[model samples]
Target: MIKFNMAPTARKLVNEVMAVKPGERALIVTDSGRSPTITEALAQAVAGAGAELAIVHMSPRLMGGIDPPPHVSAAIHASDVVFLQLSYATFHTDTIRGALAGGTRTLEMWGFEEEMMVVGGANVDHAEMESISLKLTERLTRAKRGRMTTPEGSDISFSLDGREGFALLQTAHGPGEHCACPGGEATICPVRGSASGVLVSPFCIEHKDLGQISAPMRIEVKAGLAVSASGSPEGERFWAILDEAGELAKNVAEFAFGTNGACRKRVTVREAKKAMGTCHMAFGDSQSLAGEVNTPLHVDMIYDRPTVWLDDEMVMKDGNILI
Candidate 1:
C-alpha cells in the first residue's frame, strides 16, 4: 500500500485540535482491522508535544457502538486525551461516556481511510466550520419541530421539543468534550416516538453488505420507528440489520446536516456525511448524543440537497443555508 504523509494532520490533531499539554497523558486506540499508519503518526505527534503517550491494539468490533476491551476502557478513563482509531465507532458505548464524564477529551476517527488524512474533510477550516455548526445548532435547540425534504421524495418531520443540538467542530478543546475528526455537522435527537414520514436517501454509511447504496432507498417512519424500507436490494439489507437488532434499532435517532466546505461529493461515507449542503438521518443508539434511545447499532443514511425547516422558519433550502 502507498504511504501517505499523515504527520502534518496528526500534529494538528495533537497540538491544535486536542491541544495536548506537556506532561498530559494521551492514548491512541486502534484495532487489528484498521491501518496503523495514522495511529503511529498520532503517537509521534503526542510524544513530540511532550505528552505521555500510550498506544493500544485489539480485535475489531462487529459493528458500531460496541465497547472496547476492559483494559482499554480503563486506559481511556485515565488519559487526558484519546484518539479512537478503531475499525468501528465506539462513540455510543458506555466506555466513551465514562471517559467523557471523567474529563477525558476524545476524538472519534472510526472508519477513517489513509487518504482522508491528506485531503478531503481533513483540510477544512475548522474555525469557520465551528461557527457555522454552532449557528445551526442554536437554531435547532430553539425550534420545537423540524421537517426535512429531498428531491428524491423524502419528507420527514419530528419534534425537537426539549432536544439539545450538538455541533461537531472537529475539536475537543476542553475536558469532558468529545468530537469526531473531519466532523462538521449540526445535529439533534428527535423525541422518541415523535418522527413520522418517508425518508429517502441515496446512500448509507457502513453496512455489512451495502457500502455505497446501489440505489435510492425509501424508508417509512411512523411514530419514530422505521416501519418499512424498500426501493432497492440495499434497502432490504438495511432493513434486515434493523430487524435483527430488535425494535429499538428502528428508532429515528438523529437529524443532521453537513457543514464542512472541504468535503467532496461521492467520497467515503465518513467524509460524505460532512459534505456541505448534504444531510443525513440516523437510526438506533442515540443516547450518546443525549437522545432517549439505546441500541447496539447506529447507522446513517445520506441524501443530497435537502430543504429543511425549523418550526415555521426555513433554515436550509435546497442545500443552501437560508438561516
Candidate 2:
C-alpha cells in the first residue's frame, strides 16, 4: 500500500492546467509506480469539478514491459474524457492519438511529482499520458498547418486535417475503430496523414545521461509517425538503449508537448520532458495504445521548440501552441 501527506491546494488541476470542464467523466489512469500524494489530491479535484471519475491502475511489474492492463481499452471508450499520468503507459501512443481523434477527448498531464510530504508509490506521467490528446486534436476541427521553432532554430510543422482525414483513416485503416492497439487498427496503429498530424519535442537520452544531453536532438514526423530521428552522442545513446528492446525499437514511441514551465532536461526523463515550453517523442508500443509494442521498450526525446506546419498551415512557432 502507498500513502502521502495531503497538500492543500486547488483540487481541479484539470481546470488549471488543461481546463477540464463539467459534463466530462474523466478516466483517471495511474499505477503502483505513481505518486500516491498526487493521486489522492487529484481524486479530490475530480469530484470537485462536478464530473465523474474512473480510475485505472496499470500493473506495477508491467511498467517497463510492452503489455498494458486490458481495462484501459473499455474505459477509454466508455468515458467522455480521460486523464493519464503514467510514464510507461504513455508509450501506448495509439490509445492517446486514436482516442482523441475518435471523439474521446483527454487532458494531458505529465511529469508531476508530490510536493509537501509526498511519498513515491508509483510513477504517473500525466503529461506523457494525456497531453497528446490536446496536441493532436486541437486542430482537428479546423485543422490548419503552421511552423514552430526549436530552441536550436530548427523549424517543424504540426496540425490536423479537416473532418475528412479523420474519417478516411479511421474507416480505411486496417484496424478501423480498433486502431489504438494490435488487435486491429483499433488495437495497434500506424501513421495515417491528413494535415500533418503528430508533433514531437527535441530532447535527447543517452547512456547513463538520460538526465542531460551532450548532443542536440532533431526529430521529424508526418501524419502520425516519426520519419526521422537525430541527436549527437546523446541521440545515439538514446537509441542504443531503445535498440535493446528488440521489436519495440521499431516503433517511434512518443509524441508529446511540454507544460512544465520550470523543467529542462538534464539527467532524469521526468524533469527534461516536464520542462515547460517543449515536447518529446518516443518510438515503441505506445502503452497509451499499444503499437509496435511487443516488448516493453520505449524511449522519449525532448527538443526546445520547432516550427510546425500542419496541413500547410502554421499552429506552433518557436515551441508555442498557436491554438
Candidate 3:
C-alpha cells in the first residue's frame, strides 16, 4: 500500500498527462503486482474527467514479451485510450500493436513506484520536456552519421543515414500514440551492419539497485551486433539474457539520451534512465524503431558523461546537449 497522498497526482495523470477529454472511454490495465491504492485513485480521476472508465486486473505475465489474455485484448481495442499501470508492461506485445493499429492511444506507466507517481520526473512540466525532446530529435533526424565517446573508455561509431529520431513526449494528442509519463528521450536506430567499436558501461541498468557502479562492464560491437561482454556479474547476466534470446537479440537497437531534467536516482532504473546528462544503448527488438532486428527482449544499458557527434558536428559533450 502506498503511504502518500497520490490522489492529486493521479488526477493530474488522468487529466493532464493522459489528456482524457469528455465522453472518451479510458481503460486502466493492471496486473496483480500493481498497487490498488494508485489504481483506485486513477479510477476516481477518470470518472471526474467525464470519461467512461473500466478497470481490469489480470494475472501477471510469465515473461516480459508475452501477450495479455484475450478479454484484456478486447478491452484494449474497445477503448479510445488506455493507461497501462502494470508491473510488467504491455507495450511490446502484439495486443498493444494491434490496438495502436486500430487508432487507440496508450500510456505505458510500467513499474512506477508510489512516490514517483506524485513527484520527481513524473510530475515535470510535460510541455517543456516535449519541446526539449523535439528540438534534439530534429537535430538527430537531420544527421546522416554519428559518433560517441566517453572519458571512461567508450568509443562507438554508427550510421544514421535515412533514419529518423523518435521521442516519447508524454502526451497522446494523436492516433496510435504511445508515451511514458516520465518520458523525455530522443532516440535513433543505427543502420544495420554499420556500427562498430567498444562501449565501456560504467553503470548498468540491471545493476542500478546497487546505486553505483561496482565493477565496470565492457561490450564489444561488430557489424551492429554485440559480439561479447566482459567484467562484473551484472555484465555476465546482461550477456546471458541476450544470448538466451538468440541471434537477433545481439543487434544494436537504439542510441538515445535522456532529457528529463526533473528525474533523479531511485530504487530502480526507471527514473535514472530518464535523468538528464545520461545516455543509454538498447539491444534487441528494433523493428518498431525502423531497424531490421526483431527479438522478444529489449534491454537498455546506461552510462554517464557521453560525448556525441553527428558527423563532424558535436551535438552533446560530456552528457550535456550542446545544440
Cα error, candidate 2, residue 17 (Å): 4.5
lDDT of 3 at 79: 96
Judging by TM-score, tell me the better candidate of 1 and 3.
1
**Model 3 residue 222 lDDT score:** 99
The TM-score obtained by model 3 is 0.91
Clash totals for all models, in order?
0, 92, 0
State the local distance difference test value for candidate 2. 0.46
The runs of at least 3 residues in candidate 3 whose Cα sits more than 4 Å from the true structure, single-residue gaps closed, are 1-4, 59-66, 69-71, 206-213
Task: Note the residue pairs that clash in candidate 1.
Answer: none
Best by TM-score: 1
Q: lDDT at 226 for candidate 2?
A: 47
Backbone steric clashes in candidate 2, count: 92
Top-lDDT structure, candidate number: 1
lDDT of each: 0.88, 0.46, 0.80
